[model samples]
Target chain A: MGVTGRAKRGKTEGPILKKCSTGIKGLDEITGGGLPQGRPTLVCGGTGCGKTLLAMEFLLRGALNYGEPGVFMSFEEKPDELVQNYASLGFDLEGLVAQHRLVLEYVYIERSEIEETGEYDLEALFIRLGHAIDSIGAKRVVLDTVEALFSGFSNESILRAELRRLFRFLKSKGVTAIITGEQGERTLTRYGLEEYVADCVIFLNHTVSDQIATRHLRIIKYRGSSHGTNEYPFLIDQQGFSVMPITSLGLDHPAFTERISTGIPRLDTMLGGEGYFRGSSILVSGTAGTGKSSMAAHFVDGACSRGERCLYFAFEESQNQIIRNMRSIGIDLEQWVKKGLLRFHNTRPSLYGLEMHLVALHKEVERFDPAVVVVDPISNLVTAAAPKEVKAMLSRLIDYLKLKRITAFCTDLTSAGGGILEQTEVGVSSLMDAWLLLQNIEGSGERNRGLYILKARGIAHSNQIREFFLTDRGIALRDVYVGPGGVLTGTARIAQEARDAAASTLHRQEIERKQRELERKKKTVDAQIIALKTEYELEREELQQAVAQERLRDDVVMKESMEMARARQADAVPTTAGGKQGRGGRKR
Target chain B: MIAAEGKRVHNGDGEQWILRLYVAGQTPKCLTAFANLKKICEEHLAGQYRIEIIDLLVHPELAKGDQILALPTLVRKLPEPVKKIIGDLSNTEKVLVGLDIRPFK
Candidate 1:
């Protein structure tokens, strides 16, 4: 249908259902275009649901923006009342009327003041509306609360017939009209005016869930056109109605390979040595006092330092408070704010409804056109809305930022309960492209911060849980040490290191003492050997002396014996003695 | 055309009754309402009555003065208190009661 419509429009094939722009922010996109041209659209809703305002804005926009004259014929409110009411919203209705671009007509109907005596028709009404439209050459018309005629007339048949004719008359006049009706219990309108204006029908609903009021707009039917069927949340403030069709921003946002820093260099090293993708959404979740906000502030500071605009949404703390707290951590955000690179929007989550908060965020982001956005502690928003609602709102925010190619840095505060510490209370973790989980590591009577990358799509991130610290200069990430018990951090690791050093020193001292004692013992044994050698030498000398003396005496004795032997007994005995002596020498 | 009969009087104080009839054009409903109003005035108010006819098609801006929305509407403009009766004045009794020609007691 979209293709055919575009093709027909491109060819200008004899007015193929030309669209009239509604001039409402985000509404035209939802309706594929605006309402069908030269046809009447029925806007029905319950009382106090902004039906009249929507109709008024449509006509006002037609006159002011499109340069097409409009006629506003109200049956419920007088022209002056409407002028006064719209003046607060910065819409100069009276000025438009003075410029001859708009016509305001009030149709007064009082059943008690008139008595019907015979058959009649609503010819005066038709003439009045036609005259008003013709007076200004109006291209747009708004009959706010036309259902007032139902209560003013007694004949339903005549009123219904006249209404049907009115719609036809409006169509014949080629004026795009918005006819508002009060919502009925069963039908879309009280008098079933939807049955007449069947070309397009839009329904506005105001509902209060958990004491928070939210307004929604839904296109019920649009003939010959395709429209978004989802109920979009709309906001009406000082500005006019703004519809947020977040679902329209599917997952088609451009994926950028450009990487931006997380401010802390070590943390960036943990995330593939670069940082989060330029348009990616990063979630920093942790328990209280785990430096989540500090981490986010670092991100904002990094973006600001790079000369890019950053918008910080502080839900729990005021601007001054955040500045003061961040200053303690050596992050001077005040200077960035002064330089117009960083903007701080501080509001309590309970100040407005969830949808209102979302709308405010949208407005601020649009105005600032920042390159990065930070929502410090999104968990506080859960108090204003249900967790499911918070998730939906965050997803919309993330999608909007992603579509704008703006990096979003959000902090989540998890409760210190038995629940999984890795999980966020708002459950927006799944929507984030990079998730950094901060935890409190309590051991050895001290609590220390630890940070780890839970998941980072399309990046090879470290799986180690690095010990996180908020130093006086900035954030510091150090590798946690593995002890005999488990991974150690803080004072426990310090103590273990000290103990290891002392034990190594003691072992070195003991080895030195043992070496000295062994050297002394070896010296003592050498001395003993020296003394024994000296004693042996002395003994040998004494033996030599004794042996010489003995030899002399033996020689002398032998000579005497030889003489005696020679004298008396035997030359044979002398020869035997000489051989024995030679033998003895050989043995020695 | 306006019809004026101010010479004859047949009511207390002889106060003149000024009746204005509003119509978009010369439709049958306008003719019937004019005829019925004339007959009733001749019988009840006599010469102390004046009927003015206004055609909205000629002067559409005049509709805002009387807050006129219905066709053939009769507005009693000069009876100290204004009274409006819509539709063609074919029912005489209801018209009398509506215009206070004969108050319902």
Candidate 2:
């Protein structure tokens, strides 16, 4: 029982206290693994705050779940009434009694019946509790509303001393115990039983705000162990009491490097080449009728197509309503629902408080163990809870899903505004790994849906605002870059594209006319060149013929002169033997 | 409680007062409370009251029906509005005022 080193940050990870699980949801975690093992813990609350139920569940869970028999000394309720009350929670108290594993003894302490004849200690109570424990070999005990015995007292000191002795006796018996007390006007308990059972003190409070009754539990103090020091919301349903502790526990969840498809292929294109990171949280913030639910349905459809289990939590629409609405957009969730691969938990936010919603969602997610979870419009939770509560719930939920490596998509509904990325109620943008903003682009006499990725961790995403139209096949992203600065969408984009096509066609026709004129000029040039070459060839041929004729005339003239001069020299010189022979041959 | 009617109408017109004394196993305080209640009734409503004593030790379930948290309590059952006087009825003046009993005027 001495001081330890480095206990401030609670780094000593082994069993710090010999603890046992309360078997109450989230209570063990808040209690640093449950109430101290063999010590009595005081449970005090006002009337009808479920003090008895909490104590009874502790004993019952000890008996049934941990194989630890327990004895219940009810100062208020009878054994039969207890059995009846717990029967609804599926606790078979009678069966345990019949087996002699659980002993439920109702000690009637009538105030007016017994006069304090003398100084009487609660030694008789210790005897009865001891006998019950020995009879059942019990390891746990409960004294419900120990303050009931105080009514018959005339002296406060005697009552206080007896109460102190009773706790000491119970502790000496070496059995983990629970003692319930009614809340005082301003004190911890009616009799200050807290001072007696100082090992652990759990306080249950019932508060009504805004016409809603919310039950909360807090561990006022627990000695020798570090406990969660915050008020946690608890619910007492047919299964009995369950506490919800929205704790972060220092953010120790594993991360994944894998990617998953975002349903719409074009949306996937916007999110790098693959899609969102596996086990990452995505926020799709949008205004009314901005196709947020449709996007969620498409995500579910994509998950189902991959044969991964998916759960969709819808706050605004019913299961059949969403199924029918998605059918129009070519995303069929009904078939997956039938196939048992998809589950829809549709509930109204006003039906329960935010903590209850968180508890219900936690239960379903644990039960279904889905690979992907989609919450359509988490703004309902934001609307139903305070800002701090919503943030805490979101952080815890994100941590839980990250631990399970589940891809979660949450849609936040922003008010109808002129710009995207408007201030949301929960302000959970920092908790998300990827965020997509969907907006209504109302201009040029039409309302068009625009989508853009605000940020995606570990992936390079498109910075362009994609104008997507929901078609019968699915969502189709249009080529919206009309020009360097003009970003058109919807019908406006279609008109602008058509006009651009006409202008480009006109430009193309002018280029074609110039090409045709160049071809005609080239044809005329070729025809003229051919005519000049033909004329040149004809003239060259005449010149060559003239030269040949001139040569022949010169020869003939020379021959005539020679013939005249040499008529007698017939012979003339010129006509030698070869010439004469040639003349003769020509004459012949 | 009457079965045929949705609500029971208590008879408050000059009727005898029906009272119950809850005790535990013949204790001294139980005897004292019984004696005190009878003395008061005889003095104020002589021959016009009836007293029933219930030992919680023998029948503890009866305590639940009466919402009895303290022992030796005096319950004025049938005087229109039921009244409870806790403790051993030691204060006669307080018990008379709690039971709303006046002398025959």
Instruction: Give residue A273's lDDT in candidate 1 (0 to 100).
Output: 91
As for candidate 2, its clashing pairs are A110-B71, A111-B70, A111-B71, A112-B71, A112-B72, A113-B72, A569-A572
Instruction: Tell me the whole-model lDDT of each prediction, alpha carbons only.
Output: 0.89, 0.81
Docking class of 2: incorrect
The C-alpha stretches of model 2 lying farther than 4 A from their native spots are A1-16, A248-250, A382-384, A418-421, A482-487, A502-588, B1-105
Chain A TM-score across all models, in listed order? 0.82, 0.82
**Candidate 2 at residue B38, lDDT?**
82
Q: Of the native A-B interface contacts, what share survives in model 1?
A: 0.76
> Positional deviation of A394 in candidate 2, in angstroms?
3.4
C-alpha displacement of A449 in model 2, angstroms?
Answer: 0.5
lDDT of 2 by residue, A1-588 (tens): 234555643545755668868798789989878889889999999999989999999999998889999999887788899999899999999999998879997877655444333223343455566667877898899999888787755667867887787788888888899999999998989888888999999999988765556788999989988888888888887778888776725577777889999998888888888999999999999898888888888889999999999989989999999988889989888899999999999998878877778778888999999999998888888666677777877877888888889999999988775464555558888999999988887767888888988899998999988888888777777656545545677778887888889999999999999999999999999999999999999999999999899768766865886677677665436455645665567547
On residues A1-588, what C-alpha lDDT tens digit does candidate 1 reach at each position? 999998877766665678999999878989988999999999999999899998889988888889999999999999899999999999998899999999999988888888888877787888888889889899999998789998888988988888899999999999999999899999999889998999999999998878888888999999988889988888898888888886878889999999999999988888889999999999999999999999988998899899999999999999999999999999999999999999999999999888889988998999999999999889999988889878888999999999999999999999996569888999998999999999988788898999989999998999999997898888999889887787788999788889889999999999999999999999999999999999999999999999899878766766777688778865467556674686588659
- By summed lDDT, which 10 consecutive residues of candidate 2 chain A come out lowest? A114-123
